[model samples]
Target: MGKQMTEMLKGTLEGIVLAILSVRPAYGYEITARLREQGFADIAEGTVYALLVRIERNGLVGVEKVPSEKGPPRKVYSLNVPGREYLEEFWTTWGFLADRLGQLKEEGK
Candidate 1:
């Protein structure tokens, strides 16, 4: 990815991960795979885990330990009420920024 994309992701990854959890509960590996499938090819697993830790610490998500066939147990995360609220705010903020940036791009064109 380009430097600009990388920089943008640094600010947006948390919201992106929250949006994913809002859709459904998933474990760390599942979240990473989903991000990759969604075109976040440059995202690292460590980055996602770190973001998960932060959100969990912030009380945005609830974690449950579920038995995994391939492992001892897997920690699955689901979006709590606070997480849903946060995601709504994220979308609103993202929309405003995107609209202003779009205007800038059009002006440049």
Candidate 2:
């Protein structure tokens, strides 16, 4: 994808990642695979990891090491109480912005 599109998509990456984790906890690679399968292939693999680190640092999510039978133990991430609260706030704000955008588009027509 071009730089502009990638930049545009960046803003939503955190929300998308958080939303996925909300359904179930997952490690980095699993999250990347799920995002690709769900049509977010344009997102670079590193971007997801970076976002995860940022979210964790922000105290919105927490991580724990889970032993893997086949390979090294993996760090699994899940939403914490703060994460759920942030997600709720994000949903409300996004919903309002989405409705306003739709109305503006209709008016422009």
Candidate 3:
């Protein structure tokens, strides 16, 4: 991907990660898989982990260790109360921004 593509996607990356976690609790790898399946293959794997740590630090999310049926323990992540609230705010703002951008494009055309 080019610089512009990265720049365009940057704003929504955190929200996308949070939105996925909202559906269910997930470990890091599981989150990566979900992102790939959702067509975010261009996202750097390290970036996801970094975001996870940041969100956790920000008190927006919580992590719990669950015994894995197969291998080692897994740290499962879920949205905390603050996370849900933030997501709701993000959704509202994103909707408004997207609509405004669409209107601007239409007018430009």
Candidate 4:
């Protein structure tokens, strides 16, 4: 993706990460891999780790340390109550924006 897509991703990435965690708890690398599988090839592992730290600090996620086979233990993050509420708000706002944009596009046609 280019600059514009990257910029847009910055605004919604937190909500996206929360949505990912709603399904299952995962660590930073796992989240990055999931994002890539979802077509977000430009999302870096470091970025996900930073976001995870932020959300953890904000009390949006519950974390547990799970020992890995090879490396150190990984901190698996799961969406908490506040995180789910935030995700709901994000989707509502996204739907509003999408509707407006769709109408604008249709008018331009």
14-108 in candidate 2: lDDT tens per residue?
88788888998999989999988987777778888899999999998889999999898988999999998888888887899899999999999
Q: What are the per-residue Cα lDDT tens digits for candidate 4 across 1-106?
A: 8999889987699989999999988998889998999999988888889999999998999999999998989999999999899889999999999999999999
Model 3 lowest lDDT segment of ten: 2-11
lDDT of every predicted structure (CA atoms): 0.92, 0.87, 0.88, 0.92
User: Candidate 3: where is the Cα deviation over 4 Å?
Assistant: 69-72
Instruction: Estimate, for each residue in 1-109, the C-alpha lDDT of model 3 and write its tens digit.
Output: 6788789777688898899889988988789888888777777888888999999999989999999988888889999999999999989989999999999999998
Model 4 root mean square deviation, Cα atoms:
0.9
Candidate with better lDDT, 2 vs 4? 4
Candidate RMSDs in order:
1.0, 1.6, 1.5, 0.9
Model 4, position 29: C-alpha lDDT score: 84
lDDT of 1 by residue, 50-88 (tens): 988999999999999999889678889999999999999
The residue ranges of model 4 lying beyond 4 angstroms of the native Cα positions read: none
